[model samples]
Target: MNVLVIGKGGREHALVQKLSESPMVDELYAAPGNAGITEATCVDIVETDIDGLIALVHSKDIGMTIVGPEAPLELGIADRFHEAGLKVFAPTQKAALLEGSKSYAKAFMQRHEIPSAAYATFSDPEAAKDYIQAQGVPIVVKADGLAAGKGVVVAETTEEAIEAVDDMLVNKRFADAGATVVIEEFMEGKEFSLMAFVNGKDVYPMITARDHKRAYNQDKGPNTGGMGGYAPVPDVSAEDLTFSYEHILQKTADGLIAEGRSFTGVLYAGLMMTQEGPKVIEFNTRFGDPETQIILPLMKNDLLQVFEDVLAGKDPELEWEDQASVGVVLAANGYPEAYKKGMPIPQINGNVYTAYAGVAGTDEQLVANGGRVLLVGAKNDTAPEAAKTVYQALKQIDNNTDYFYRTDIGL
Candidate 1:
């Protein structure tokens, strides 16, 4: 079957790479793919170009199209493709609202009795400020709509919370995405990502992964999608994983079905392990960037087969490797903010995998083209061992100085 994977990032790159390895896939393609996705033929249609994409799918006789990012799903690409009589693996727009709107997700969690932080939504800046002040310090401020991954701000002070409110509601930093805000009490605990292949109420959870959202070392600096991550997190106990699967991921799938917004595709829960149990911090309707790069490699089952079986309402009986996988992002020098691009990507040597997130050109001509340039990952019997091997490969690019990556991944 000819398959087309949408989006242009590390996540899409991983999907393309994995799908290409499937014998069920006769021809593989990626829309607007980055430089590192050599396994699939890259298409030029942008993810938001619904008409163009539909036409391309028909023209190429693509059997299945997998949506990789939230933007196109929020734009109802799946709905459009279905309308055009095409097979698309993604949730409808209404179902994708769980990730597209923070306020909507908060309300849904409340309605479904799912565990999450207590939050209040506001459109007025003054009202938001007042609430932040009353809530005291250490709160979370989030833009109601998608802002890439920078909409969230964990404010430790009332002043900082107010500032974030002003930025979203007053300064319009995130544009329309920030017009409304959801302020929540900061839940204290370690964070982990649990992604599952979801088809309506049927959910198959993947291995747990811990993503380092902070840009700099020791958890400092602003978040930039994700800086690094490791799968099969050692610190997360098996009991906790079971609790998260049942209370969080499973409940969410059932809730979406009951709400008349049945979801299909990757459902990612950004969760925190509180003293009480696992609670959702946020949700993503598509595969996570750094997390996908690390976790997908650990899956023993064929990627296309999993998607097909899930779509058919059949159990894929997914299996994963016993080895641990760690991935680190190589971002532009001053990432999570403004930075330069087009710096030549150095040749990576060693037994490691590379998922190009942001680059242009091909082969030796590849150059950094976005904030997060690429991800370097490795698999080993232990997380520490994988991290060591990945970091050693990254040292090969350190001399360029135009890119930077976290030094403490999987520590």
Candidate 2:
């Protein structure tokens, strides 16, 4: 069957590559896909144009539409596809509120007794500032709406907290996304990514991954989409994984179902392994970027079949290789900020798998087209070995100074 994968990033590239390997798939297509995904036919439809996407689905006879990014999912693309009698692998708009609106997610977590940091929502800048002053320093201020994963600010001082509040509410840093803010106490711990396939209350957890969100090394600098990641994080024990599935993942799916919005797509939980236990920092309704780049390589199951089974409300059998995978994102210089693009790229070689996030040029040559250019992933028996393989291949790309990647990934 023909499969349509949405979005134009490393995540979609990974999905396309995996789906292309499926014997059940006759053809694969990607909407606005990147340059490295040569395995699939790239389409011209933008992700947010739901009508255009629906029309394309019908025109291409796409048997299943697998969404990659959160924006399109939050825009109700799946709902529209369902209305048109098309099978789509994504959550409905109502269910996407788990990621679209921070306040709503926090409220839902609280209502369902899901373990998460205590937070309060505020719209007024003055009111928010007053609350921050009372709450003390070292807090997390988040834009209630999406801001391309940069809407959150972790303040270490009361002054910084107030300033962030003003930046969001008064200066409109994130624009409409910052109109309302959710401030929560900062929890200290190692962070891990747990993604699961969900259909109503059936939640199947995948291998755990930990992504570096900070731009520079040593967790310094501002946050970017993601710098690097590795799967089956060593610190996250099997017990922790079981706790996440039973207490967080399952409860979340049940809560959504009870609210009359049964989710039917990837449910990603950004968790912090605190001293007390694992607590959710945030929830994403779709697959994560760099994490997907690493995890997909270790998946031993056919991705297309998994999507079909999940959509049919049948528990999909997922298998993963007993190997660790690491992915390092090579971003354009000055990434997560103003950066140059259109720089020529050399050939990538070795055992590394390159998932392009941004690039534009003819087949003969490729150039950086966005902040994050591509992700180079490698698989091995251990995380350190995988990281070594990835970095060794990354070193082969000539003129390394043009792009920046976190060196501490998987260390």
Q: CA lDDT, every prediction?
A: 0.92, 0.91
C-alpha-based local distance difference test score of model 1? 0.92
**Tens-digit per-residue lDDT, 1-411, candidate 2:** 999999999899999989989999998999988776799999888999998888888888999989999889778988898899999989999999999999999999999999999999999999999999898989999999999988988999898888889889999989898999999999999999999999888898999999999999999998889998999898888888899999999999999999998998999999999998999999999998789989988999999889988878787889999999989888999999899998986577888888988888878899999999898888999989988988888777646678888887876
Evaluate model 1: give its TM-score: 0.99
Global fold similarity of model 2 (TM-score): 0.98
State in Å the error of residue 143, model 1: 0.5
Candidate 2 global Cα RMSD = 1.1
Off-target runs (Cα >4 Å) in candidate 1 are none
RMSD in order of candidates = 0.9, 1.1
Candidate 2 colliding pairs: none
Question: lDDT value for candidate 2?
Answer: 0.91
The numbered model that scores best in lDDT is: 1
| lDDT per residue (tens digit) for residues 319-374 in model 1 | 99999999999899888889998788888899999999889987759988999989
TM-score top scorer: 1
